[model samples]
Target: MTNSRGGKRERLASAAARVLHEQGVEKTTLADIARAADVPVGNVYYYFKTKDQLVEAAIDAQDSDLRTMIEALEAMPDPRERLKTMVGGWVDQRDLAARYGCPTGTLAAELDKRADGLDERIGAVIRTFLDWMERQFKEMGRDDARELAVALLAAYQGISVLTNALRDPELMVMEGRRLTAWLDTL
Candidate 1:
């Protein structure tokens, strides 16, 4: 039901996103999501039959947010500026990244061991960014655009790991600046 908080379904999806980002798939329960969303735990079953369905809702929410951000980033005509700005955006999330690590990276790492196709579902979140970064590199006339894309994400995820391990948001900012400079050379 819609109220001052918006649709319950939407709130649940948002809660799933936040909880999943902070807590990982295995650690996060439907009850946890329901509580975070301020909905009755039983009501969750009315909207999503299973936890996987709820996780999928969270993935959908991430995809939608990513699309909106990507769309805005695409408005920049220059590919290099687009990428640099993207790094700056990551820098903006230094605190969160430092605290929880890269949300997509952590999710992928946790889901990777699972037998179900959820791994690939969460993986597409990274792949989506990879594809966009690849396009940007391609526009820069790089012969190995895909390779650069992989390298870029790899560096970001690596930095995120270090950021969390060291409990230093400044590390991400430092790496973000370095990545932006590296992008300039590409």
Candidate 2:
């Protein structure tokens, strides 16, 4: 029963992610998520005590997939190739932002007015992701991989914003390849 409940919550969380990504955090309500998930409005409360909790869960759901990707990178012993593979996945999949507009950025931009620790949670997730990326860079002989990781992350975030605004998925892959090419030169 616990596992089943957890599955239901996951389904709810995924539905919340879709709603939040499509409508932005401010516009996403429990009702919206409930409708999207095909679950009752009260069911949302059962899974998530508050809107913030729902948002956090949704963000967590998005990162769950990302964490898998990070693990995949860790499996690749070579840093450069790992970084390439990881970033390449994002660049190659242009609809990422269209489906979910950079969860970190979306959370950061929305949670600006939220309670104090809310932003911290988002920050922590992003930091973990960047740190993982930097680890790969460090393995590639770039002692200052942290800085490079930050730059690469920024580029990806900026690309997501631009792609979402312009509805151009191709630019993501183009810029990703361009960024990787530049990294190769370095």
Q: Per-prediction count of colliding residue pairs?
A: 0, 0
Q: For candidate 2, lDDT tens digit of each residue in 48-86? A: 889888888887876787798888777876777887787
Best by lDDT: 1
Which runs in model 1 stand beyond 4 Å of their true positions? 1-6
Each prediction's TM-score versus the true structure: 0.93, 0.90
CA lDDT scores, all candidates in order: 0.90, 0.81
Least lDDT summed over 10 consecutive residues: which range in candidate 2?
96-105
Candidate 1 positional error at 175, Å: 0.4
Candidate 1 per-residue lDDT, tens place, 1-186, comes to 246344888899999989999998989999999999999999999889999999889988888888899999999999999999989999999999888998778878887898698888988887898999999999999999999999998999999999998999999989988998899787
**CA shift at 77, candidate 2, in angstroms?**
2.5
